[model samples]
Target: MPTAELPSATPPSTAVPAVDLRGVAVRYGPAKAPVTALEGVTLTVAEGEFVVLVGPSGCGKTTLLRVVAGFEHPTDGTAEVLGAVPSPGRGTGLVFQQPRLFPWRTVGGNLAFALARQGLARTERPARIMELLTLVGLPGFERRRTWELSGGQQQRVAIARALAGTPRLLLLDEPFAALDAITRERLQEELRTLADVTGTTVVFVTHSAEEAVLLGSRVLVMAAEPGRVAAELPIGLERGPHTEVAALRATPEFARLRGELNLALTSAAAGTGEEGQLPPAS
Candidate 1:
């Protein structure tokens, strides 16, 4: 679950990078016996970019996400979000593989809790709750108990809660990984649309190449064993308000990108270092 830290005193700035990390590294355990999770990872995410990280297990995808969210600090290098050091509640929203909703709260109540944590006053919460629910395609679900909702619906509520803070950056860690195929696809479409509509910077972590291609404006493939970026691909999908996921996925370009990502992922896992360039989308 995302920590409910108070928003920073300074308002988020659009003038600077949404996320900037320079030669970042993370390690655990004692000084001499530290287990490295990430090494020499430098990444910059501009405002409104949907960046996805995909790699095999033990890669630093989740560690990178944690660093950006201010949940975990990098052992080396500097990380800044919106021109300031990242800290919990500092203009970030987080969602994970599990919905992690408060079972005790009703749908609206959960959102209300988040809104309040983000400094929203009580009087403003009701309207904001309804708006968030509507945005997530769950209009009028304010009264629904979290336990009463299906897995997909529960995740939707979780997303709504995450957005309640109107976060400038949204961090999602395989939020759709646990769902059934159909539900996962639906949520993927919804999430992509939501990101566009909200214009929020996002860093999503997943193991699926298809999901990376489908959602990210930029896809990063990381190599494990002291994880580092092995490949970077820009998803140059031409999209508009009316673009549909089904139509987009059926295109030859989508297939090519997916194939490229898969090959890169394989190479990275094997430490082959063969596929690193971003070829022309044409």
Candidate 2:
């Protein structure tokens, strides 16, 4: 297999934040009565930071993720990734709630297609495919059909395929929401490890406060009816491979942060407006 360098629209730069959004808004429908999915969203994700967006349904969590992914443009303000306006084919990878893999192709075949698009040569693809499968904990399962794997395994493949492009920023919209509790927990740990190993900046969207607390270095709580950031809480708990999952969650700090975030969500839903713009956690 030939090794191909991942294509990047913008060169790497530590000076630029992984993501920058200022007073961003997204609206749809007619000029007379447009649906506002998001409004007054201001966020900045530093390089290698794991940030989670949590909010109620229709709060525009997914909409904000799409804005960063370049699938949707904001109606106001600026959105930038890696120092430039977000664009498709930029150094970013996306994983959705469902594992959107091709059933017709084998796991390896699916990965091969992505690698080919990255300009990796046919001869170089096999090795790269194995490497990716291994990274996603699917080692030597390349030849298996997508339909043969369990849902968790299939999602792993989807994640591996996303990483095949070697994205500098990884955007996930509730990727593990559909999984069972046990499977979701396992994937969360794996994702944390993967992030540490790859140093890829992550912007994850989830409705679960526990998931947000477990996976995010910092959690951004959003409110509905024109989504906006309501609170930002930093998880000071230990993370990555070194941390014990059950023990960490059981700690006092973990519980405290989780409680705070839940309160923020509750306030947002109740429309108290009291939690309207807490300063970003330092």
Candidate 3:
């Protein structure tokens, strides 16, 4: 099948992109009967952009994220992050669907662990942990044990831990999928605000079109059989410091955009191998 045509990965400016992938592919098992996980995938995520990958299960969203995180190597083509080849501990942070925290540690301990890896001095860790917690809306909760916190709170601590290393790129794979609707929506808004405040480039994966539309500055819809991008849409919502999620969701423009993304996702799940007929980004 011909690779779907995606929007150009290059940014409007000359600055190097946070992620650059060209003809990237991943396959597994015997050569004769190799199962292709991703094929002819090309993507570029600009610095400070919140890019979301939305697709059904088995569409290689997590696989693509792992490729960028340097946890998995591509079988063909080149992938670069921060203008260089990607590898573990290369100025990137990751959050999985589960809050993979150290069970023995307190929330502060978790952030301290990451800070220590970044070569922070012991004397400075206390202040830094508080600061990081504040950023995630868990101020002064560092002393709480991981098991003592609720699911959303634990994930907030997990996010703080990831931020301790001051990574330029943050990769998240369905981090809020397990939470209740109320908690998930709250975290979604918080995360969007956090991204804006910190200016961190984010590549998030999700199966929900609503979540993608709510949080992403741009969204990419992917197909399943030999997973590849089936569509790309730039979100043009007028978000500001005062913008509320409820108010934003009630707008006609927001509904229209959501409908468009839903249609793209439907086409991708249908396995038609056809690119979405979206208008060119302005």
TM-scores for all candidates?
0.92, 0.92, 0.95
Q: What's the CA error at residue 124 for candidate 3, in Å? A: 1.2
Candidate 2 residues 1-282, lDDT tens each? 111111121223456788988889899999899999998887788899899999899888999999999999999989999888999758999999998999999999999989998899999999999999999899999899999999999999999988988999999999998999888888888899899999999999999999999888888888888787776776678764667567778888888778777877887777774454432222
Clashing pairs in 1: none
Give, for candidate 2, the lowest lDDT window spanning 10 residues.
Answer: 1-10
Q: Pick the candidate with the highest lDDT.
A: 3
Which lDDT tens digits does candidate 1 get at residues 99-207? Answer: 9999999999999889888888999999999899999999999998999999999999988988988899999999998999999989988999999999999999999
Task: Report per-prediction Cα RMSD to one decimal.
Answer: 6.8, 7.7, 3.1
lDDT of each: 0.86, 0.85, 0.88
Candidate 3: where are CA atoms >4 Å away? 1-9, 279-282
Could you tell me the lDDT of residue 211 within candidate 3? 89
Instruction: In candidate 3, list every pair of residues with a backbone clash.
Output: none
